[model samples]
Target: MKLLVVLVSFLAACKAQNPEPCTSPALLSGQLTLATQNEQLWAFARYLYDALGQRIRLQEMGFYQNKSFTYDALLLYREGVMYEINNQESTCKKRALRADFHPMAVPRNASLMGQAVLGSSSGPGQGVLVNTWTGHLPDNARYLVTVTEFGCIPISTSYRTQPFGWMVTSFFNNVIGISDPNQLNPPGFCQDALHEEPIDFFSLFHMMK
Candidate 1:
């Protein structure tokens, strides 16, 4: 009954979107550029990566505040690829909004930098979110990067490959104990991250040194 109540409350508290007709496809096409100079994207990049400083431990639940709402994110990796589930919340911000819908599969010591356009099928010829994300990892870095939820705010949609925007301007508070087979299963554990308050990526960067 408690679980049912949470689900019911989530459905009621959350505002669902009635999407208008999609006039076009949400097409994003671009090459991976590690050092591309797209000013807007770089700004987002700086914000997301904490200027290449925030540190995250595998399986650790991290929260970032933006627009008075908190985003729940988990940054974990195994073998060589980095796994990220940017928006993971329940009973709040459960609009199923996703950022980085495709888990950024960054290789160890390599960067996952690319330019892409998020299009609106309903908004023909109009790119909903336009930006590039450039991230570099230390040779020994365990986590991929950090985000402020809507940190790299993009022109958005309520539904997309990665979902967001125009749907309640969501706020999420719960950042742990959700069901993901991959949760905390990796080369390392997130006990350290859970024990300490999330530090600015800058401080995390220093820890790497």
Candidate 2:
């Protein structure tokens, strides 16, 4: 009986050490910064993401080629479309977006790297616990992503891909829910925006440069 009790306790401890996968909140808003070496672009954006509604909105400002630019993008995964609005020129363009909504979660195939506390772990409420995972992507790209262990809030993501070098995006200042649902709507100017052939969303930044 004594040996059985000890074995049960050991199994419980092992289970506690390896957590199950977690998904982020369905609705969230946050600030994100992105950098890409090959593109030589640095961008900051305020984003409203609605995973349940399958849409997202981004108000982005970036510098490339020593020039500053700003734009707003509304991505509708369900509609398979994206609206890119140039706030400065009051011009908008609509294009196909052949991507599905990707929730901020650790992929099932991801290999766990490790876990650590971001600050003092000696005391409760003194630090955040996080987990890191790495996986390969299509096109020979690889990714390493970190997220808060509790809510699965994304902390950072790094992608190594051919032709693009490395691109890193860090997320911060996240709030659990969308404050304004109307923010998901496209701007009025986009109503009659000219339809263009589908293009990769990231390439839009380079075109502006």
Candidate 3:
């Protein structure tokens, strides 16, 4: 009887160490900062993500080659369209986005790197448990991401792409819901934007430079 009890306890401990994967909330708003290690590019943005609606909007300021510019991008994945509005130039460009909406969830093939507490574990309401995972995208890009263990809120992600080298993106000041539902809509000026040829989303980074 004592051996059986020990075996059950050991199984419970192992389960706790390797919890099941979790999906993040469908709607969220946050601040995002992205930087490239191999390029002279840095960007900051306020983002609204609606996974259920298959849309995302980013009001971004980017610095490249000592020039700073601001733009707003609305990606409508369900419609396979993306609108890029240049706040400085008062111009808008529309292009086809052939990518599908990728939820902020751990991929089925991801390998868990480990788990750690961000603050003092003994302190009440102080520490946050986080899980780290590494995986590869279908396009052959590799990524390492860390998310909160409870809600699966993303903390940071580092990805390496063939053309751009390595880039790191951090998410913070996030809340569970979109503050303004209309924030996802493209500006009125985009109504007249001409549709351009389809291009990979990563190509925008190259254009920014």
lDDT for each residue of candidate 2 in 1-209, tens digit (9 for 90 to 100): 99999999999999997955678899999999988877677889999989998999989889876788776888998898898877678788899987767887878888899998988899999999999998887665789999998889989999984545788999999999998998798777788988899966556666655
Best lDDT goes to which candidate? 3
lDDT (CA) per prediction: 0.26, 0.85, 0.86
TM-score of each: 0.17, 0.90, 0.89
* Ranking of all candidate structures by their lDDT, best first: 3, 2, 1
The candidate that achieves the highest TM-score relative to the unseen native structure: 2
How many clashing residue pairs appear in each of the predictions shown?
Answer: 8, 0, 0
TM-score of 3: 0.89
Query: For model 1, how does the per-residue alpha-carbon lDDT over 1-209 read when each residue is reduced to its tens digit?
Result: 99999998788666442111111112211111111112111101111111111222222212222212222333321222232333332221111112222222222333333334445546666643332223333333222231122223322211111112112112122232223433333223322222233333223212221
lDDT of 3 at 60: 83
- Model 1 TM: 0.17
- Where does candidate 2 stray beyond 4 Å? 87-90
lDDT head-to-head 1 vs 2, winner:
2
